[model samples]
Target: MFMNLLRENKIVAGILTILRLYLGYAWFTAGLGKIQSGAFNASGFLGNAVANPVKGPDGSVVYAWYVKFLESFAIPNVDIFNFIVPWGETLVGLGLMLGCLTTAAAFFGLVMNFSFFLAGTVSHIPTDLFLGFIILAAGYNAGRIGLDRWVVPFIRKTVLKGKEPAKQHA
Candidate 1:
């Protein structure tokens, strides 16, 4: 029911536009800061996350597998992280802000949010994750007020081979 409203209601779409802009601004600033900081590096951050994976009440790592994966893959490839983290955030922010490929942008945003959560950093992630899910749930309506309004239809018509309805003879 709520999802229907989000997907079909213009009022809800307007509200979503506000949410999208807010999240986009947040991401843009964060990424821009990181890019501007010549000394920015993910090595220390990734190492800390691996060293202190979120612990359960019993003091065991809640996401042991994730921790191991980070150790094996992420930690060893800090250089790649150095490039991906900042630029990815920037691109995601731009996509969300422009309402272009909104679902994909929101999806990636949620992925980053979850990654941060799993890394035991609980800042604005919980709120961001919830909002990101809402944006994703809204689907096409989420981008209705922005570029997706045109881009989605273009893709459907050109790439997906959507056909126009036939006109009746008068």
Candidate 2:
């Protein structure tokens, strides 16, 4: 019942828009700061994550595999992270703020949030993850006030044509 309202109701949609804008602003500012710094690099961050992964109650690494992956793939490819992180954050912000692809943007934002959380960075990740989930759960309604209002329908009509059921005989 509540999910239905969140997915369809205008009042809930308005609330979601506010949430989306706030999240977008956060992402935009973070990314913009990195870009503006002109020397922002993910190597230090990735190194820190690899050095101090989230620990379990038993004092063992909670995400050992992820730490390994980061060491093997991410740390070596720090150059890629240097490029992808800031730009990806900025793009996610733009997509969410403009409501162009709200669900996708929120999904990616959640992925990044989880990554940070798993890397022992608590910060605002829990709140961001919760809000990202809300935006995703709201789904199409989340983007109804923005470009997805038109773009989604256009894609459904054109790209997904010929998939609709034809009229059946009595």
Best by lDDT: 1
RMSD of each: 5.1, 4.0
Candidate 1 per-residue lDDT over residues 59-137, each given as its tens digit: 9889999899899999998899888888889988888898999999999999988988889999889999999999998
* Model 2 stretches astray by more than 4 angstroms: 162-170
Q: Mind giving the per-residue lDDT tens digits that candidate 2 earns over 61-152?
A: 98999999899999999888888888889988998899988999999999888888888898898999999999999888999888889977
Compared with the true structure, the alpha-carbon lDDT of candidate 2 equals: 0.88
The CA lDDT of each predicted structure is 0.89, 0.88
Ten contiguous residues with the weakest lDDT in model 2 = 161-170
